[model samples]
Target: MSINARLFYVYRIVSRMYFHLSVLFVYFFTLDLPVWKIELLLGVYAIVLLLTSKLNAAMLTRMPHKQVIALGELIKAGGLAALIANEHLGILLVGQILSGLGYSLAQGTDSSLLRTIMPDMQAYKKAESGSSSYTFASFLLSGIIGSIIFNYSHEYAFWCSIGANAIAITAVLLIREPAHTNTQQEARGAKPTETSAQKFWKLYYSITRAFAMATFVGFLPYYFFTQTQVSLNIFGLILSLFTLLGFISARFIVRAGNVYGFAKIAATSALLCTASMALLGSSSYLPFGIVALAVLGLASGGVRPLTLSNLNMGEWTPTQRTALLSSMEQSFGLWNAILLIAGGFAIDSIGFQWLMLILAVVYVVLMTVGYWLYHIHTAQPTAAAEQIQ
Candidate 1:
């Protein structure tokens, strides 16, 4: 792999540092806003992330990738500093909105750039394994480090995230574009490839479907808030534990996908989700609640990467696909804002367990949607092949 490609891998390692820094964001996130208000902000923030994903995709296809990403990073850094000073709910919301752009740029372009460095599809997959695993491990490590930082000093913990992001920004700037990019561009017209427009729609479908899957996955927070009703400290610990477990479980999920293929793995995951939801709906005992929620963690961890990693399967370069994923993530924030608040309200108005019943039904419906879309996606190819015959 080229130096730039190595940087892409190394950048993943450095991202652990960014996670460490985010430990303190919860402080600023809730500073002036009520918990309900905070949830609302998060909802809006998610929508912006989706929009950012769209813009980043456009820029990558139409402009210089490196420069565009750098500009977004610069804006992010500035936005963070502004939040530190402004600290108003409105100001904080704006900062988060712009930060979505930063996320989109980094995710989309980084993977795309690495593809340029490693053009052979098989070779690229093999190479991605190392970075992907390290990044996964880093999540647990960051949570540990974040906990330690929070225990000692919340302010310092947040600063750690800032420093890590700063390093990421610098590292991104140093990466040199691959020589292959120009060669590929010159050879582009040799045979017409898929148009960017078709690629974009494919990207949209893959991501939105993934996002739909996530609607069920995000039950962690609701479960914590409603079922346990623990203090923020305990809530954080549980959430971290969930992520840590999810991180550990993700490796096995990857293998399962490789062995059985992503479609089957996804189907199996949906099955787990349906079962878990049913358990949550009917189980009155706290232990049953815990078990049901853990099942959710297992299902979510297993499926998230399966869907996210392969999202580019349609035709876009890794970068464009990643950007599409980022857009999907942004949509996630939006969906979260609406769904979470609704869940909270429903909990207050109706019984908490009843809300689970509704979500359970939603889960089953989403799985059906997943199955339908998979067939739809597969049918197109099969139909095309039949026509070719």
Candidate 2:
């Protein structure tokens, strides 16, 4: 691995550690607050994230990527500081807003920077997968460590998160942007045959895949505990297993995309996710549910790297790539906010099983239609060019 790739992996590890350190403490810290207030905090955070994504997209043309990443990390550390104080609901809301801004600013740029620095697309894909695996590993380790720390003091956990963020910021600062990046980007400009419609579909697929995974992550535990009657201890073990499988899949399965093609791998992943979700909804058997969860985990982990590989295949300019990726992040935040509001109402109205089944069918229809549209749009241009020739 190159120095940049190593530094990137280090950044991923510590940044993810920062993220997951307080994951289990969100509800715990807000226990005294009303449910409505907690929801308000989440709403504030999501809105801030969406708005900041737009801002980040606009700023990409003017700011250096490393500077943006470092500034975002600094801001995140400040946000963690506020949470560490934890005096009032108002303070917590401020913390969430700061964290959201920081997260949105930094989220898409790191991958963009990695792509810019690496001349070889294959190396970039490998590094991307490796970084993702590191992230998942960090998630597992940080969760365990955070839980242990939280058992003693919440403040200590938040402080440790800030320390991790600081380390990530340092890593970002150490990364040297290649001087030939722009030349390489220009040399590999989008193919003449590519169209805006094709680009849109590629991005759309990624956004949809991310939204589906987010929904599952948000709701699966509830469905398992309430509907399937899984005990807490067993559920925790299952979740750990899921995370482990995700790490392994990200590390190894993504390489298969090079052999079988990313599009095929992505489609297969989507199908697997749909099947797993449907199976979970249709069955009450504990073993079946566990198997479904495991499949979902593997699919979810590999799908992200595949989608990212697809998105970058166009060889867009750094600015264009960053803007599009930021837009995707914005879409994710919007969809997630919508899911948080609607998914609860859906479960209340129709129950978790029905909701899952409906979502499965809906996703299938969407994917089919998206593929058809992509085919029509791409085929028309090729046919026109051929006739002109």
Candidate 3:
């Protein structure tokens, strides 16, 4: 493997370890707060991500990718620092804001960097899939290990997250900067090949899928803790199973897409997401919920590589690619913010099961309409094709 690929693998492992650890611990740390207040923390985090993504899009052209990524890791570490320093709600909010900003900066740049350095698109896709698998592998390890660590000492778990960020930052430092061919094209005022309608559809798909996945994952711990008889260790193992499937799925989803077609894979993933949510909401039985989560894990893992492959399909300048990816991330943040805030209140009123069922219905409508619009837009031939016809 190339140095970049190896470093990227390390980065994925450590960064996702940080993420999984934080997510697992954050719930218990804020357990004293009302659920809405807890959810508000994530809502605020999403809002910051949405706003910062816009800022990153504007600044990406001016900044070195490595520098931006390194700075993001540092800021994320600082955010973890803030979280561990105090358990106060106000401090936690500050931590989340900083974390959101950092995450936004680093989110899509890795793939951009990978694309820049790797000459072959297929190679890049392989590397991307490999990195994603590494991420989920880390997720699996961290979820179980972090839970165990948290059970012993919350301070240790948070420290491990900070350490992971530190390692990631070091990895960023070692990465060699690539020639910015796409940025140079942008500098010369070359227009992107992607149309506005295409961008809209991309954002639409991103928002719907992200909202469903985020909502499901975010509240899953609470669901298992409150609604089921599962123990903390068992819950951790369940999460391990989830990420294990995700790891497996990410490895093959791209190949599956190539064979069966991306549209079919995407559509099937959406239906799976819908069914998983409905199944989860319908029954509190452990087996049923586990089955639902497994389905969700499969859907979530497969769709991500598919989406990334789709996004990387067209001829796009580096700046445009980064900006477009940022926009997708921004869309996720916007909808997730709305979901977290509204769903918090909804959870307080209607409870988790009812809220989940409502969300499942909403997802079905949103995805169906999104796919319909996408079909309409895509079915129309390009100007060149029309002229040839």
Cα lDDT, model 3, residue 335: 81
- Evaluated against the true structure, the overall lDDT of model 3 is 0.73
> What TM-score would every model get versus the actual structure?
0.75, 0.81, 0.91
Error of 1 at 156 (Å): 2.5
In the range 250-332, model 2's lDDT, one tens digit per residue, is 88766786677555666677788788779877976778877877877777776556556656444576666777777777766
* True lDDT of residue 175, candidate 3: 78
RMSD of candidate 1 to the truth, in angstroms, is 5.2
Off by over 4 Å in 1: 16-32, 61-63, 179-234, 275-294, 302-305, 308-334, 373-389
lDDT (tens digit, per residue) of candidate 3 on 193-265: 6653455446545765565556555667667766674666787788676787778888888888778866667
Show the lowest summed lDDT stretch of 10 residues, model 2: 20-29
Off by over 4 Å in 3: 19-31, 179-193, 196-205, 377-389
Error of 3 at 173 (Å): 1.6
Which has the greatest TM-score? 3
* 331 Cα displacement, candidate 2 (Å): 2.1
